[model samples]
Target: MTDLWADYVDASPEQAEALPARGPFGDSPALADELLALVLAGGKRATSGPPDPDEPVTVGGHWVVSDGSDRERVILRTTEVRAGRLDSVDDRFAADEGEGDLSRGYWLQEHRTFVRRVLGLSATTDVDDVEMIFERFRVVWPPEHADALD
Candidate 1:
C-alpha cells in the first residue's frame, strides 16, 4: 500500500505527459486559483452528503477514467505540495457486493453541481500538471487505500 502521504507520485506515463490549454472557460491562472481554493477548502473529496463541520478541510487529487466495464476508476491518492497535503473521502468511500458505485455518483453529482455552480474541474489542463497539483496538494487516509502507494 502507498503511504498516507507521498513526496513523489507513481503516475501513468500517459498521465505524466498530459497538459491542457486554455479554453472558452476563461483565464488559466484564475481557474487554477479557483481549483486551489476548492482544493484548500475541502481537498478533492467526492462526498455522499455535505461534509462534517468538524472535519479538517484539505486538498485532494486523483485521476478518473471510465474502465472497460464503464465503471469509473477513481484513483484516489495523497499529494505533497508547498501548500500542504490532501486527499478525498471518496477515496475512502467503500462499496459492498452489487452495490452502486459511490465514486461514480460522487463525481457525477460533484460535476453536475460544479458545472451548474462552481464552474468546471479544469480548463484544458494537462494530466501531469493535474498530477503535480495532486502530488503537491492532495491529502488522504493512508490505511484505506493501502494498495495505491509506492
Candidate 2:
C-alpha cells in the first residue's frame, strides 16, 4: 500500500497528499477481488455503504484501492457523494455500481443480502430505512483508458 501511494504521489505531484485507504472492497477475499476487477475495468465507478459520519467522503479526495490481499493497485478520486436511505438508491446509481445486470432490482436484492450479512441483521429484518452513503469516483492512478466510461 505504501509503495503504491508513493508511486502515485511521485507521478502526480500537483495532486493533494494521499488520504488513508478505505477498502479492498466487499466482506471477503473473493468478493473483494471480484469488485476490484470491475473497478479496474472501468465497469464500476460507484459504491455505497453504511454512513460513516466521522469520515465522510469528499469530492476530489483521492483513495487507494487494494486487492483482497491488501495490496494497493489503484487510486480513485471521488467525484460525488450522496447520503440517503437504502430505499432511495436510484437506477442510475445502480448502473454505476456495475454489478448484476446493471439494474436497480439486482442492486437492491444483492445489497439487501449484503447489508444484512455485514451488519449481522436477521434475514427477516427490514433494511429499507437503513442509512447509506453512495459515492462515485474515477480512476486517477496508472491512468484510465480513453474509452473508459465516466
Candidate 3:
C-alpha cells in the first residue's frame, strides 16, 4: 500500500538524508495527529512513552512522528531522553505538552486514561509513580525549511 503520510511529508533526498529512521509517536492515529499538531504549533516540546528498562533510550536520534494510521507527520530530533517516575512528571513538563488546559491534573487524568486504554491495561492499574521514558525533542524537517508540507 502507498504510504499514508506521503502527502503530508517532504520526502526529498536531502530531507531523507537527515531523517535517518523514525518511529511513530502515539498508540492511535488520532492521538498521533493530535500531538503532532501541538508540536507544529510550537505548543508541545516534550512527550512521554512507556518505559523499557532493558532498552537504551537514544538521544540525538531522528524520529518520524506519525498519526494513528502510521503516516509520517514531522521529523523530530531527540534532544534529551531520560527515564523518570510517572509521579515526578511535574507541572512544568505537563504544561509543555500543551494538551488540555496545560495542567498537571489534566495531564495525569488524560495520560492515565491513555495508558490504560491504549496501552491495554486494567482500569484499576496504579500508575501514580510508574516508570516512564520522557523525551524532549525539536522539529528537524519542516522547521528547517520555509516551505509548508502541502
lDDT of each: 0.30, 0.83, 0.70
**How do the residues 85-112 of candidate 2 rate in per-residue lDDT, one tens digit apiece?**
9989999999999998999999999999
Report the error of model 3 at residue 22, Å: 3.0
> Could you tell me the lDDT of residue 44 within candidate 3?
89
lDDT of 3: 0.70
Q: List the candidate 2 regions with Cα displacement exceeding 4 Å.
A: 144-150
Best by lDDT: 2
Candidate 1 wrongly placed segments (more than 4 Å):
1-6, 9-27, 47-138, 141-150
- Give the per-residue lDDT of model 3 (tens digit) for 77-141: 66788787777788988998789999999999988877777667899998776677878777756
User: How do all models score by TM-score?
Assistant: 0.21, 0.90, 0.75
The backbone clash count of each candidate, in order, is: 19, 0, 4
If ranked by TM-score, best first, what sequence of candidates would result? Answer: 2, 3, 1
Model 1 score (lDDT): 0.30
Mark the 10 consecutive residues where model 3 has the least summed lDDT.
141-150
